[model samples]
Target: MPESTPFHDLAAFIALPRVSSLALSPDGTRLVTAVQELSSDRTRFIGALWEVDPSGERPARRLTRSGRGESAPGFLPDGTLLFLSSRPAADPGEGADDKQEAALWSLPAEGGEASQLLVRAGGIDGYATATAAARIALAAGLLPGAADAEQDERLREARRKAKVSAILHESVPVRYWDHDLGPAVPHVFGVPDAGAEPSVMVDCGARRIGGSGHIAVSPDGSLIAYTAALGTLPDEIRDAVVVVDAATGKQLRVLEAPDAEFGAAAFTPDSRHLVCVRERRITWDSPGDVTLWLADATDDQDPGRDLLPAFEQWPGAPVVSPVPGEDGTPVVWFTADEGGHAPVFRLSTGSGDIVRLTTSGAYSDVVASPDGATLYALRSAVDSPPAPVRLDAAASGQEPVTLPSPGQPAALPGSLTEVHTTAEDGTALRAWLVLPQDARPDTPAPLLLWVHGGPQTSWNAWHWRWSPWVAAAAGYAVLLPDPALSTGYGQHMHERGWAHWGGASYQDVLALTDAALRRDDLDGERTAMMGGSYGGYMANWIATHTDRFKAIVTHASLWNMYSFAQVTDFPAYWMRRQGDPLENTERYERESPHLRAANITTPMLVIHGDKDYRVPIGEGLALWNDLARFEVPAKFLYFPDEGHWITKPNNIRLWYATVLGFLAHHVLGEQWQRPDLV
Candidate 1:
């Protein structure tokens, strides 16, 4: 290990600067990234903007500073940098609130102090900028029955004075993943220019809810495309792309189908066409599919053309190239999970041909240059943190040039390798094996089988919350696998575990673990397993099925299938997959981990957050009670003010410390010791 690296220190690892997003200038001469770090008090992570040389020559430099920090970096046509901040206005009379919501701010390209550009009564949730038309669109919240800004403010003040926190709902989705909806509806507004007040472009209607899923403005700035809910019921609440006149806010077209959901809209450079992701809705027996679709902006009647009908992998957000092909066809680029790697690919609108631009690592926040010859993105893998990289958009199987990044992570204390195996159904499964630096054949490292969340998601990119390096640094070999329901393996792989979450997925996970344990550097005897969310559910399931491991750590996991399906933030979504528990009791009885709680012999640690509506606090309380009833060794770590994922710096530090301590006690045969400041 390098002497300068602090991989062994938990404090240093938690305090390391983390990058979340990237934005390239319209001219592609400059790139900006959002780097988050522990605040002065080390209570939370705050973000600031940093500039990087697109040419990868000069080192990166900080561009903005504030106690509240800045984020959502964007570039206007005039080269001015735009961002969102809650910082007070320079002038006290500007009506700046010290505890105010986030507002739009601008910093000149030539270098100067950033100033407030636009402020809304509800602040700005998100914004999009148009380079060619020099326009900005913002997503803001508005109170019901309020038609304008003044009315909106009056409504807010009235509600506060009345000490009311109630929201009446007429829709099925009364609550989202973490919070209740209503009281204030979301709308999209068109800001005439910087420092100018915005005008409401779309009301989004009360029933529409959740505002727009993904918003995009045409290059010519004449039209705007966004995603909106199609209906109010849970199953009927499908998303569709809606295009409207930018200035008048008159609806022009609605692109949708009975069985397809559309989102992540992007307009072509010429503004003649639009491309968005089309996902086929899943059913009881069949898994859904995702592909790209090209829609004609001029004619609303056209159903649009499929761009990659035969592509097996599910693509991420679509980004249209600024430059067209030689035949005047628009070019689109997107990143997708293939095997264990997430790479960038180019799709020709004319030929419907796909070209892979990158071969390894995961790429996101893709930005294309004006000429479409070069692409910029943030790339990361299991062994690396996110860093800016530039790649040839037209190249095949090429590596990207790493750009100068600010506050890059310290070198790892260990290395990563790939482990592959064949499932019972003859399907190939793979996982990343992270081995500690000191592991040898005679003295093997203790194995930590860490399952990933998003049962539908793959372990293709770097993650801050569930980082495997922390375990590896603690001298445990971590196995990150993508089982049956994991993406990137095509539709059939997902179908195998569609409604049967505990069947093939569980077997595949065990199969991959069997393969990894066969390696000489890993100790099969001194092993433990851990997971969060869906992975947490699996840990509980594994405990019930087998005692192969000595300990298990389950975080924000689902324990009771019937209750979880009905009480989760998205009850309808889960019900759609598992069917109504009242009617489908057999599936729930057979798969739910709680049903076999008596079979769990492995000592376990349960972690959950009170604010996590996704899994809910009730699930954690019930799991703890069940463990106590069954006489299984258990401890419950509860957070009073956190969501599905722990975000606060101190909270995250404690999470890592506690998990490490738990594993050390059970797997390393050490005395149980509590993490400090718990």
Candidate 2:
């Protein structure tokens, strides 16, 4: 294979098609994936569906095409493909509007033009189809006091004519990540078959916050399980699994625990049992653990059985095997972060045995064959983009067979290697080191320490947002480290930095950087640090603690702990770790990066998005204000239309251009040059 050019050419890099998700047909002979490409104007991404051959004999082909694009592909029992699309309908009288929300569409297995299947007044947010009963369940938003679709339309028109945008909320959480949850409450509706009007199954009243479409129908189509908050208080907002009758939409059972939360319900192949994830709630000192539980689908009063009592690694959503075991018992499969990789693992319901399947790389979108002989998933690693792969369901520590992928990304421009170091407290620390192809000991590349977000997330997979190859293309060695609080490292590793976010985790990062800088191929003297979100928080912390780096870049960073804990989208989640500022000022004062802003001497570039609710734009404003007040050399990069991430293609290009320019000026002693548009 020819070596791909480094991502220095922003246009070329942004134009490359990116694959997001995968879905397999019932028989597993056909696979579909969602690929996103830059829009014609090169400002945003448009998604479309593509089909990959499971036999690997034929090249993947495009399955659906529309200007508005299609996504969330799933297969009905009859081999028809069901997906959501916002494209205008072919019929003028169908009331299709280009700006309307996505509606469900179906393409027959016999190969014909697709047609709109279900159109809701509020538009369908998501839907799930049952294999045995052929029933469909949809999640749609309902206007208050509107009982049916006609009433919903009437209320919407009235509001539009009155020019009213007010949302009366009596709940604790009025807003989610990026949107307001208000006058239109989310409800799950049942559709007996295609083209049938949906009947409300679960009405999440005005105050009840329901899942946005996180629902699963039983194999027999007898029950629909969804997530809903048990209480209205901030601390009591943990989600619980609710099972209801599929036909009547009547509540059958409520699964909840005082110390743990449950979600992601999957029914067994026999439809006799439902398996769900149980996540222990997080506290100020203890990091939570996740395991699986089995509940009887028929009995509402019976408590579920704990499958993995002492599982160390936090498991992802549980997926029941389509095929039963040889002894007539069911099996569950899931992926979990282990060391530096996320691998698939299978659990035997009969013996309670857990076995690791794939050895390396992160796997997702797992789909089991009808006979349960094979599993299909999208696999990715630090050096590889996501690609379809087939795995033997019953095997352990086996390599997966690569299937033909549509628009596979170009080969990486640089080489990847793993680096390891022990933290001060004896915890293992690891990172993926991306080195330039031309790097040599005589001409060492400048080092760029890239901290990952989710301070709790590990750098176990490929990421397009903060890809290290771009820096490597610019002749820099990038250090992608997973320090304390990073997942896949077991509960103890998370506990090391549980409440003290900046203490051990910060030291672990420095320790790993020290280990990497010891390499002769990496130049320690010409080093810089950059991170976003939690990583950005660490960058701010680093700027205050040490003057070792010449420059630092922080994006969507949390600077003031006191203010951030209160203003973030999830105040309760942050307060769980730092405690309330009114009562617990010690943690805020000891760990906050803004309090020590005056001690920083490194030149900093602060980046933020005005629409970001996770970190909030106020963090950037406060950091910029403090930098100016302290007479620090700093620059602020602002994105008005972006959210937590700079997702727009043009905006992202500018981000990289400005970042590279900043590093060149500060770390390499080059003349400062402003980026093109900014």
Candidate 3:
């Protein structure tokens, strides 16, 4: 058989054919999941919907009974299941590509033939539709039409089927946060519920929610409030909550976000008001605060009250919570960064009184159910994986109900050890080291110090990836560090590397290496580094600054701020974070690894998606040219039809295959097939 792919690899995992979705039933007693399954013999794989009575003691039962059809499952408040199913893409396996043709289906909770709820010619994303609320909301994607690629398609197909012609008129669309089907194309809005048909209240126009967007309904059903983009992502835009007319899709008023960003806002159970978490995003220093916005439905213009400045940062802890009052007007029931812990807090919206809920050292994203009777919170930690906690939150006020892992739990290697070490500047850098189970201190196994890309991001709290997992399975130790900039800790800790690109920030990984050397489980002689985006930048930095590693793999990396400022998708953002390269030209030179290509002596494999606008592939190409000119060991890997992320199963398989082989050969000192070598 082909080499036993590790559990972490996409082929092994996606190959399992399972679905993962979170949908709550109308009564909240039943939860639905969209799962895919393979026949017992393992030849055929099927995608279908399944429901489990969270309150019952039974296995989940299948809901959808169709062909290779069904995915993106959601729950409607009235007890119906809404989902998207794979339909015939005019181009066959193009799947949900150009046609965007997945038929939206709604099936009764009791069960029956699924009915098509909404079927448009094209354009849709994971959607939101009310069960009995009479409104549906979906993101509209940018459609690529016949105006551009018809000639190429016609010529290519003419040589094949002879009859196959390019019939492309309009294709896929760019999906965004807000859209109202009533106004048609180009216009979008926040969803509304007027007891009549649902409409949009806030317009997205060309704006997008760089992350996730949530729409909230008032308990009274007379008003609607939704998270909306006030700016464009070219600037990496932030969003705000707006009060909207439930019937006309009209924006009554918009709550001005105090910080550059705000998130996951929710209304009180009574629906007369809402509370939002405000956060500034200019630097690593986050000023996390909670602000309340109110609208009485009758008072249109002055719906918002004075911004309540009630809480401050709690170090090492982050809680996700928004309270719509249990019985009275909605108060700002939230969690704060109080005394270095993210315990749940019940703060009175009217009086600003703070009450501590959970004293646990970690927790986040807490949400109370519609009736204010149940609260679901996702608890987190640096080394601890995330688990759900359901609280009565009211009387009896019982303990929390912990949620189970998504599908099957990640098969973490038994050798994994959580450790903390001191960086060059004495900052504490934490890491999760996974050594082979049989690895002995004398074995000297190769090390793969996997730097999480965010620089502002992190790899922690149950880190699972197909790439690193396979690397570990191949006899390499994977070091995952939440260096700095990783949230969970207060903003101060995350902002540790604000503008210090390769300064102290770069030394942390090396320091982590020093720490690993002290550990008997790791092999200090053979080591390699890999990461994407910001992590990619650091891989280049380490490769150039030190000749210690045997090999390196960098993906979607930014090589030069000078060129990157102009070519990247987030131009304004780079300028904001790094200061205009035009002004701080010298800093860009000092920060970029490209300036010292001659110094990098490690065997390197560079990969990039050609269509990735985030960290443009030009940076990768530039590095490849420099490495070749300097006779430094290197090769360039490119994916033509991909974005910052590789989505197509074929590309994903190919991409990881290359990295796996590269590391196996260089770091593990084992002969593995790799195109880079060829």
**Number of the top lDDT candidate:** 1
For 17-98, candidate 3 gives per-residue lDDT tens digits of 3434446665666666656555444444567776654543565577766655588766666777778865443344433343
lDDT of 3 at 4: 41
Reference-based TM-score, model 2? 0.97
Per-residue error for 607 in candidate 3, Å, reads 1.3
- Per-model TM-score, in order, reads 0.97, 0.97, 0.77
Error of 2 at 403 (Å): 1.1
Winner on lDDT (1 vs 2): 1
Worst 10 residues of 1 by lDDT: 203-212
- True lDDT of residue 366, candidate 2: 86
Error of 1 at 468 (Å): 1.0
Compute the lDDT for candidate 3: 0.58
TM-score comparison, 1 vs 3, better candidate:
1
Return the lDDT, model 3, position 503: 70
After superposing candidate 3, which stretches have Cα over 4 Å from the reference? Answer: 1-10, 17-19, 36-48, 65-72, 85-98, 126-186, 189-213, 231-238, 257-259, 283-371, 375-406, 424-426, 461-467, 675-678
lDDT of 2 by residue, 1-678 (tens): 325583758788888788877777876678999998888888778898889888888998888888888999987888899999888787835344645678899999888899988877667888887877777878778898898777887898799789999999776676666566768887777777675755434442222453333678888788888777777688877778877787777788878887778888889987778898888888887788788889987687888888988678888888888878877888889998888899999899889888899999999888888887788888988887888889998789988888887657576668998899888777778988999877789989899999999977899898888889888878789999999889988889888888788999899889999999999998989999999999999999999999999999999999999999888877887787788888988889999999998899999999999989888899999999999999899999999988889888999899998999999999999999999888
* Candidate order by decreasing TM-score: 1, 2, 3
